[model samples]
Target: MLQLDLKTTVFLASIMSALMSVVLLSAYHSFPRSIRGIGQWVAGSLVLVVAPMLFWLRDIAPAWISIVLANGLLLAAVALWTLGTQAFYGRPPARRPAAIVVVAATLAVTWFVYGRESYEARVTIVTFAMGIFFGAQALLVLRHGGRDFSARFFGFLLAVQTLVVLARGMASLFAGLGGQTLFAANDVIQTVYLGSYTLMDLGLSVAFMLVITRRLHVELDILSRTDPLTQLLNRRALYDAGQRELAHMAEHGGEMALLLIDLDHFKHINDSLGHAEGDRVLTAFSAMLKRELPAGAHPGRFGGEEFLVLLPRTTMAAALALAERLRATSSRFFGRQVADLTISIGVASVDKAEHRLDGAVRRADLALYRAKSAGRNRVEAVMEAAA
Candidate 1:
C-alpha cells in the first residue's frame, strides 16, 4: 500500500505551480505587443501567489489563512478574466457587472465557510467557488469573442482549468462524506489529476507563445512588402509581381498593360503645405487609384510620387481606355481644393512579337517624358517603331 502524506502533496503542487509560473513568464516576455499585456501579468500573479501559499500551508497555524489565500487567487483570476475579455473581445466595462459580483460573493462565502465548525463545509465551499469562477470565465470568453484564435485559445484553457478544479472538489467531497474507502487509491488518483492539469497548463502556454510569434512574423512580412507612406505595394513587390505576370504571359500568350503615373510638380505640394499634407495627398491619390482600378489590376507605389499599375489580360486599346478613365476620375476628385493636381500617365502593353516587359516600360518612360513636354494631365501610349 502506497500511502501519501499531506506535506508531500503540498510540496509537489508548489513545485509544479512554480514551474508553470516560470514558463508563463518566459512566454510573456517573448509575446508580441499585439497580445494584451495585462492578461500576462494576471497569469503571472496567480502562479506566484498560489505557489508560495501551497508551500506555506503546513506552517500556517490557522487554516483560515489558506482559505484566504485561495480566495485571493480566485479574485486575481476574476480580474484577469475581465482584462482578457476586454482585450480579446473589445467588451465594454459596463457589460458584465455580474462577474465582479460573483467573485466578491465567492470570496465572502469562502471566508465565512472557513470559520464554520465543519471542515467538509470549508472544503466544499472553496472548491465550488473556484470551479464556478473558472467555468464562468470560459463561458464568457466563448460567448463574446470565440471567432478569434486567441479568444478561443484562452477559453479552452479556462475550461480545462475548470475541470481540474472540479476534480479536486470531488476528491475533497468524497473524503468529507465518510467515504475514506473511495480514496483507497488516493495517491494514484491524485497523481493522475495533477499530471493532467500540468499537461493542460503547459499546452495552453505553448499555444499562446506560438500564436504571438506567428502574429509578429506576419506583421514583419507585411512591412517588408509594403510602402509605409502611401500604404501601397513597394517597389520590390511591384517588380516581383511584374516578373511573375511577364512569365505567365510568355507561357500562356495573354496580354498585360503597364501604366507609369507621376504626380505633376509634387514637390510644390511638399514646399507649400509641409510633408504631412503631402503625405495626405499621396494617401488620398493612392486610395482613389485603388477604388478606380478593375479587380484584375495591381497598383503599387513605385518610389517618390511615382505609381505603377499592371492591367492583366487587357489589350493596348483597353489599357488606353482605362488610363483615360483614371485621369478623368482624378481630375474630378481633386479639382476643387488642389489646383492643377494633375498626373501624367504613360501606358504600355506587352508586345510578345517584339519586346519584353522591361523594354515596354522603357518605351512608356519615353512617352512619359513626351507627355510632360506636351503638358501634364494627359495619357500617352507608346507606339512601337517599325522593325
Candidate 2:
C-alpha cells in the first residue's frame, strides 16, 4: 500500500476539498434554484477546505488558531451539512439549534485548548460533535429521502461516516488518541480517520450531485405529464393511463368508465371575469375532482376548461352517479369570485371485450354534445357500443 505523511495527506485533503467546492459551486448554478441544497453544500465544502489547512499548521501556529479554530470550523461544516440535508428534503432548517450546537462544541474545544489542554479531550469532543451532525443528516435522508438509488447511496455514505466518526470518538475517549501529536500516532485509527474524512468528502459531494440530478429528472418528468395550472394529468398522460387500464381490463375481464366534463359558458366567464377568474374556476374543479374521485380513478385536464376521468372497474350507472355527484358538489368549491360556475358531463363505459379507448372517447364526446345542447349542467350517457 502507498503511504504519505500526515502533513502531506492533510495538505492534499485540503486541496481536494477546495476542488470539490468548485464542483459543488458549478452544480449550484447548473441546478434549478428551487432545488434548495446545492448552495448550502457549496458553503459546507468551502468551510471544509479551510479546516485541513489549519490542522496542517498546528505546531507553527498558536494552538488557539490551529487547534481551537480548526476544530470549530470542522464542527460548523458538519452543521452546515445537516442544514443542507434538511433543505434538500424540503424540511425547514433548524438554524438556531444547529448554531447553538456548533457554538457549544466550539466553546468546548476552545476551553480544552486555553484552559485544560487535553489532546484526547479535544479529539473526543470534536469527533462526537461530528458524529451527531452526520448522524442527524443520515437519519433525515434515510428516513424521508425518496426510494432512489442515489438517495440510498448518499444516505448510506453519511451513515458510514457517522459510524466512523463515533468509533473514533470512542477510541479517543477510552483508548486514547495514541500519541501527543495527531501525526505522531502513526496508528491505523488515525490513518483511517483522516483518509475517511478526505474520501467521504469526495464521495458525498459526488453523491449529492447525483441526488440532485435524479431529482431534476423526476421533476421534469412530472412537469411533462401534468397540467401546470391544475396540477392534474395532461391530455397525453390521461390517454396513456386509459390505455394501460384498458389493457388491464382486456386481460382481467373487468369494465372501465370515462367522464368527459366541460365547464358551462367558460369562455363567457373568461371574457367577463378575465382569465384570472376563469383559472380559479378550473383550479377549483380540478381540486374537486381529486377530492371526490374514487381510488382507481384517473383524472386529467383535457383542454381549456375541459377535464376527463377514467375510472377502472366502474359501470356506466356508477359513472353517471359519480358525474351527477360531481355536478351537484362543484358549486361548493368556487367562492363569490365565480359563484355561478357549473359543469356538464358525458359518461361512457366499456366492457372487457373493448380494446380501444378512442371509440369510447368519441361516444363520450357525442354524449357531452347532447348534454350541452339539452341545456348545460346536466349528465348524459351513450349506452351503445360504437360501431
Candidate 3:
C-alpha cells in the first residue's frame, strides 16, 4: 500500500506538470496578445510551483502552518481554474474585487492560524473556508454555463475535492478533541484523506488538458474547410456542400441555382500593376459578394479570378437578376482605373426534373461561355439559350 500510494502521488504530480506545460505553450502560440491568456499562464505557473510546495511542507514544524499553506495553495489553484474556465467559455472578465477577496481571506486566515495556540480550531476553520470557496465556484460553473463534457468533468472534480477538504477538516477536528487517541489511527486517516484529494486534483488537471486538446482539434478542422485569404468556404467545402444540396433537392421539389462569375481581364491587372494589387482586388470583390448575397446563399472561391455562388431556393429569373446586380456592382466599384472591370456570369437554375448539381454547373458553364463569346459583362441564363 505504501509503494502504491507513493507511485500514485508521483504519477499525479507528473501529469499536473505536463498539463501546466501544455496550457502555457498553447497560450504562447495561440493567444500571445490576449490578456486572459497571460492571466491563465500566471495562474498555471503558480499551481505548478505550489504543488511541490504542498508536498515539501507536509512535515514542516507546527502542523497547522502546513495545513494553512496547503489550503492557501489550493485557493490559488481554484482562482486559476476560474480564469481558465472563463477564457475557454468566452465569458466576460471576472471581477477583480472577488478574486482579491478570496486571496486576502485565505492569507488572513493563514496568518491568524499560524499565530493561534489551538491548532485544531485553526485547521478546521481554514479547511471549511477552502471547501466553501472551491465548492461555490464549482457550483457556479455547473449552474451557469458548463454544458460541455469538460465543464461537467471539471465541476465533478471540484465537488470531489471539496468533499476531500471537508473530510480532512472533520478528521482534524476529531483529533484535536482527543476523540481519536491512537497515533496510528490518525496516520491512517491523514494518509487516506491526502491520497484521495491528490487523486481528485490530478483528475481535474487531466480533464482540463483533454478539453484544450479537443478545442484545438476542432479549430484545425475549421481551418481546413476555410479559405485563408477570402475567409470563405474553399473549393473542397463548397463541393461537399454542393453534394449535400444535390441530395436534398433530389428528395424535395425546389429549384437550385449556380452562378459562375469570372473577372474580365484579371491577368492584365496582375501584369500592369502587381500580384499584390491583384490579390487586393480579389479580396475586395469577395467581400462585396459576401455582403451583397442574401442569407442562405453559399459563396466560395472557385479558383484564381473565379468565384461560385449557390442559391438554394432561387429560380432562373431570380438567379439572372442576382447575376446582373453583381455585374453592375463590380462595374461601379472597379471602373475608376481598373480597365473597366466587369464579370461575365453564367447562371443555371435546376429544371423541374433535374436532380444533379454537377449537371446544373455544366449548363451554367456553357451559358457563361456563350456570354463571354457574345460580350463580356453580361448575365446569360442557360434556359434562355434553349428558348
TM-score of each: 0.73, 0.96, 0.73
Candidate 1 overall lDDT versus native: 0.67
What lDDT tens digits, residue by residue, belong to model 1 across residues 228-262?
Answer: 88778998887778788877887888888889998
Error of 1 at 125 (Å): 7.4
Ranking by lDDT: 2, 3, 1
Candidate 2 deviation (Cα RMSD): 1.6
Q: lDDT of each structure? A: 0.67, 0.87, 0.70
- TM-score pick, better of 1 and 2: 2
Give the Å error, residue 107, model 3.
2.9
- Put down candidate 3 lDDT per residue, 1-387, tens digits, no spaces: 333354355346546655666666665467424323345644654565565455445555454445556556656666666666566656764748447745775666666556644545655665676676567657766775347787677678778778877877897777553443211233665566556655655566666665565566667777788888888888888888877777778787687888999998898889989998898888888898999999989999888888889888888888888899999989988886476788999998766555546677788888888889988999887774233
TM-score of structure candidate 3? 0.73
Better of 1 and 3 by lDDT: 3
lDDT of 1 at 361: 71
lDDT of 2 at 132: 87
Candidate scoring better on lDDT of 2 and 3: 2
Ordering by TM-score: 2, 3, 1
Cα RMSD for candidate 3? 5.3
Whichever of 1 and 2 has more lDDT, that candidate is 2
